[model samples]
Target: MDHSIGEIALRAGVTVKAVRYYSDLGLLDSWRAPPGHRRYDEDAVGRLELIRRLRALGIDLPTVRAVLTGERTLSDVATARAEALAVQIRTLQLRQAVLRVVAQRPEEIHQMSDFTEFDDDRQALVTDFLDAVIGDDPELRGIRQTLTPELPDDAADHQVCAWLELAQMLPDAAFRATVRQMVADWRSDWRADDLRPGVVAALRQRVGPALAAAIDPASPEARAMVDEITADYARQLGKPADHELRTRLSSLLETAGDPRWFRYLRLLAAVNGWQDPEPLQPIYDWTRTALRHAG
Candidate 1:
């Protein structure tokens, strides 16, 4: 049976105006009844349904027309639409994460205001900011690699929160200077072999336990921890584990041990969905104190 535009629209779940528009766009074909009203056969209803489905899936009208004209298969149209929708979904998700964080801290809304226009390349802006803080120092290549934020397309709230927190720090001149100075000092000490890889491992492995135990930094056990680390440092420096070495080592840690860096590490872990090592600043502080009196 033939159906009028109104009846076909009701059956196809579209407005009469939409049916007329689709007909005008050659997306739907209809015949004129003798009474001069537009009429569609049953096949028209199916075509209209296909058009609705494609449009709902974010296919553009031109692409939908191509699908209707058999220039592309339904599968091809669907695949293209899926890819486009995926990009849009990611964009919306980023905006949603930004807006949620902004809503909670309305005072910081200005921080997110301009970001609304950012596309998926927004992560590049963050990387650029990090590069400015890190500079072109080749010694910090590893730290720079680790600190780079690569937010997953399907990032959860914690990851987004990590990004928001990190983004907030990018413009902080004090924070940038702290990290820059730490990197510079680390590089300077690196040349003299004052800071070495094994030293950090020893501190983390030996001093970490004492710090966790809350042992007094001036206690005998603290001295043992300091001795273990200094021994490791002395091996790296090819020097005796003397008071002078201990003093220099303690100063190195004190200068590089910014609590902000600890926070940065924590936030990076959150962004990467890694387990937190807990806070390391406390351990560094305790070890620095212990190193001073290890004599």
Candidate 2:
């Protein structure tokens, strides 16, 4: 049956103007009426419904036309459209996160720069911290490379959050010095070959008990533990476990005990999604306290 544009639009649940627009676009075919009005065939209603359905899905007019004309299958068009929608959703989510951060910290608005502004200062700080903590040993160097967090050029909201947390930790001078001293002491005593077999084993045997007993590092009990451990270490080195050795080991424990160093590690772990190291401060403090009285 021949139908006027208005009749087709009513049957298809589309506006008259929309039907005319689709006819003009050759998406809905129409013929001339006797009175010079436009007429559409019954098939135009079905075509109008297809166009409406595709448009509702955010498929652009051109793509819709290609699908309707059979140049591309509906499945192909749908797959492409789904991919495009996914990308748009991701962009929107990132924008939402940025806005949330800005709203939460109005005072820190200046810190929110475009992702392109992720500069060398941030990169260098991250590199330096990893080096200080992990050291320059060849084995650790490879681990450092693998664990490095490279801020993306166009970071999403989560990456920005990680970057800000990492930046704050890396810039603390006290934290840097603590890490440096710890690394230096560790390197002086243990080579890569001896790390697990000697140093780790010794620390675990001697310090692990104090750590487990919850002994205060600065108490006499902790001192006894340190003395026992240092004596063992001295024997391994074929040297006397004298006062000098005790003092040196004490210094290592104290430097490694700093909470700020642990804070740095915690921040790095968070940024890299690693499991947190056990809290060592309480045990280390116990060791320090114990060492003072043991002398």
Candidate 3:
């Protein structure tokens, strides 16, 4: 059964004027009552709801009318809207980057177009940081990939914050240099240890359990863990575990193993929406304790 235009508007959460406008546009099915009152088909409420949904997605009146009249499929229109949203997101991200640079470094306002050019290669900044830190060795490909955060067009608030913080940090000259050399030491003379993950893997394997068990960093157990790791390193390098090696290893751990830079890794994980790997700061802390504690 048909209902008056007022009933259709109430059901569709629209005004009576809107229902009449659609009816005037021939987009709604309506009939005249015996008393000449305009009534709409029950299905008009469903159709009007669909029309509103499409309009909210930014579909124009002509396209929405086509959709209602069966000239276009809803699936096709939805896919088009999704693709449009992706493009819109990319444009907004580019603008946000430029504005950030301008705000952070007003002196660089003359070169603001550089940020605009970032649209062509969105990863340029990230790539430079990774190259400076890890170098361009093929052996480091996987680690490099893991470290770079890809902020999607539709990122969550935390992810956006992570990217903003990372972008700010990427331009620091001293931090970049420090991390560059630290990665070299962490990988342990990359020429010999082409397996870049092994040194950290070895350290983590020993320290993870100790950290979980809440063993004192200065305890005998922590000391044993340190001794075992140093021995393993010596075996890998075919060098004696002597004063020179101990001193170098201790310094390396102090430099690279600081949890300071690990903060950036956590931010990277957050930005990329990845599970944060086990934090290595505690591992370094345990090793540092063992080295200082002569017991």
Candidate 4:
């Protein structure tokens, strides 16, 4: 079955000139009829549709002709297109990060080149910051890895923004000392040695609920909850549920709740593209209030 040039163009939803152009390029088939007018086979409609799609992807006539003539596999054409899109998407993300810095953090625009380059010196700065805070203990290797953020060469928009935010904090002496003290305080309690993660869980599992219920920290309800939490901490430490241990629990959770420390975890998660950790600031605040009013 054959179709006139007009019929083929109409069926393919293209201009007649578009169909003729492809035919002229030898990418589509057409023949002269007895009347010396061009006619296309029904297959030309399908081929014209393919040409439109391929051309829209920026494939030139020669490659499209090769695809149409079976000189190249459609898979090969698709792979090239997918790879090109990956590069384009990565570039767009970087452009978006720059735009955000200009629009939102105009004052910080001078720092744009740092993220753009992300050279070895920039990474060394991160390493030094981590070492000052987390230390070089062999046992802390896992903890160091978890806290450290490795910004990739082709980071996404949010990741680039995250690195920018984290970088801002890197040079702040007060913040660095705060984080360093947090690690020191944590390590002092041997929570890192025996029950670091467990202590955090104790706070979330117990203090989280009473705070949500708005229980007054000084009330018996709050005291009992605190007692149970301390006892849980004692069990993790293999210590007895005694007065000293109860006091230790208050101290334990108190140090863990610094607002700045919580922000670092969030920024770390963002930089590494991990699931944002649960918001524990409120829980830490609850613990702080509970301790303040426990008398």
Which one wins by lDDT: 2 or 4?
A: 4
Summed backbone clashes in each candidate are 0, 15, 0, 0
Q: Over all chains combined, what TM-score does candidate 4 have? A: 0.62
TM-scores for candidates 1 onward, in order: 0.72, 0.58, 0.56, 0.62
Q: Which stretches of candidate 2 lie over 4 Å from their true place?
A: 113-163, 167-223, 230-261, 268-277, 281-295
The best candidate by lDDT is 1
Report the C-alpha lDDT of model 2 over 18-67, residue by residue, as the tens digit: 98888888898888978889998778778889999999998999999999
Predicted structure 2, TM vs. truth? 0.58
* Arranged by TM-score, best first: 1, 4, 2, 3
Runs of candidate 1 with Cα error greater than 4 angstroms are 1-16, 31-46, 91-104, 112-122, 133-145, 151-160, 181-198, 204-228, 239-248, 290-295
Q: If both were scored by TM-score, which would come out higher, candidate 1 or candidate 4?
A: 1
On lDDT, the stronger of 1 and 4 is 1
Which run of 10 residues does model 3 get worst, by summed lDDT? 187-196
CA error at residue 63 for candidate 3, angstroms:
20
lDDT score at residue 5, model 2, on the 0-100 scale: 81
Clashing pairs in 3: none
Can you list the residue pairs that collide in candidate 4?
none
**What ranking of all candidate models by lDDT puts the best one first?**
1, 4, 3, 2
